[model samples]
Target chain A: MSILFDIAITAFLIISGVFGLVGSYGLIKLPDPMSRLHAPTKATTLGVGGVLIASMLHAIAVEGQVSLHELLITLFLLITAPITANFIAKAHLHRHVERDQLPDAAPDDCWAVHDIEPFQAGAEPSTETTK
Target chain B: MIEYAIYFAFGCFSLGLLMNLWQIVFASGVGDRVLALDTMVINMIALLVLFGLMAGTEMFFEAAMIIAMLGFVSTVAYARFMLRGNIIE
Candidate 1:
């Protein structure tokens, strides 16, 4: 049993380490900002997740105590990573991309970040047409 | 075996942190720099967890959680500032 736990912990640690390395490498090697964004958000998040899981397993299987604190970090990370990615992507769009450079938005809708008018609360919606 | 694995993980994450530093230094745009900083924060969290495991203590969990929250907030703030020219509006 102890050996099994050791194997599991070792495997997780190595896997996560490799993932973290690859993510960072991609962040450096990727050609452009948008593609670079893809590397760390997905890969490093999984890498950190693996480390967190290994930590939890070590606490439970080796230390003989249940530690769920790592779970909170994991949950927090899972919740925020996508939001961070979205914000970064939006920032990229706003700062670097021109409207015509992008593929067209849906027929009736434009990108929210590019919208000219702020949406008002409890007010009638604007009927302005988007190009 | 686990000891060696821990060492390997340490080396990998440390190298990753160095790479993130390189990205930050040589990035082409503000977004890329922000992305690098976010990656650096994550690598730091991984290192902290590894340290806790090596030292056999749970005390670092709080530190890791705090760093995670701060990192997320800072990334959002940077992105927001880039998007709107201001952080709070």
Candidate 2:
């Protein structure tokens, strides 16, 4: 039983560490900003998640105690990571990407980031659309 | 075995943090820099957890959690600033 627990914990640590390294490597190695954005958001989140899981397992199997705080961190990270990525993508689109560079959105609509006045109070929505 | 694994994990994540630093320094755009900073925050959290494991203490979990929350908020603030030229409105 002890050996099995050791194996599991070791595997989790190594795997998560590899993932974390790969994610960070991708940040520097990927050629473009948007492609670079893809790296840390998905890969690093998984990496942290793996570490948290390993920590939980170590607390339970080895230390003979329950530790649920890791769960809270994992849940919070999972919820927030995508939102962070989306905001970054939107910022990139707004500042760096050209309207013509993106593939078309639905025929009459444009990308939300490109919309001229999405939140203006009581203003009429534009009838014209990007083509 | 577990000891060796912990050491390896520490090396990996520390190296990862260095790579994030390189990205932050050399990145061509604001978004990339923000992303690197966010990644660095995550690497720091992983290091904190590993330290907790090594020391056999739960004290670091709260610190890790707080860092996670703060990192997310700061990343969003950076992105918002980039998007609209301001953070909160």
Candidate 3:
């Protein structure tokens, strides 16, 4: 029984931490705000969610107890991540400075398409890529 | 079998930390910092949950909740800053 518990908890810890790392990587590696947005949305939320669920499972399976705090947090994260990411993306576009030159505006800065082409304007975006 | 899973998780965490840390250090602009911070929060929530599991108690779950709430507020603040040029605005 002790061995089983040890195995489960260790796996849960490692998995939880890894997902966080991958999402952060995406935050760093992607070229632009739009592209980088996908990394954390897809990886960290689900990855962290998975780890947390595993922990919950262990809590119940090992001790026959139930907890709502983690579950509620997971639920909150799932709902907020996309909405917040979208808000940031929209705000970014509105204030992005080069909105006038973007080739893929979706009738508004907030809804612009991902295929924005700057060079097609015969001039690179005057606003340097932020990094 | 579980140890292998642990190895996998460790490898993933290290790789993620490397990426986020790289971005935090090398990237310019406030947006980069905001995004990295968001990612860090996501990692933290998971960490807290697993820690709760490690202790075999529900204590870590509350920490996870607090972390999640912080993540939401921070993102909103960042978005507000981007939009109105100030979080309070």
Q: Each model's DockQ?
A: 0.68, 0.71, 0.48
Candidates sorted by lDDT, descending order? 1, 2, 3
Q: Where does the lowest 10-residue lDDT sum fall in candidate 3 chain B?
A: B1-10
Query: Candidate 2 clashing pairs?
Result: none
lDDT of 3: 0.68
Q: Is candidate 1 or 3 superior in DockQ?
A: 1
Q: How do the residues B22-82 of candidate 3 rate in per-residue lDDT, one tens digit apiece?
A: 7777876666667777777776666555555545667677777877888889888987666
- iRMSD computed for candidate 2: 1.8
lDDT of 3 by residue, A86-116 (tens): 8767666665646446565455443343233
What do the candidate models score in CA lDDT, each in turn? Answer: 0.90, 0.90, 0.68
Better of 1 and 3 by lDDT: 1
Residue A63, model 1: lDDT of: 71
Q: Identify the CAPRI category of the predicted complex in candidate 2.
A: medium
Model 1 spans > 4 angstroms off:
A116-131
For model 3, what is the alpha-carbon lDDT of residue A78? 88
How far residue A77's Cα lies from its native spot in candidate 1, in Å, is 0.6
**Greater-TM-score candidate between 2 and 3:** 2
Q: Candidates sorted by DockQ, descending order?
A: 2, 1, 3
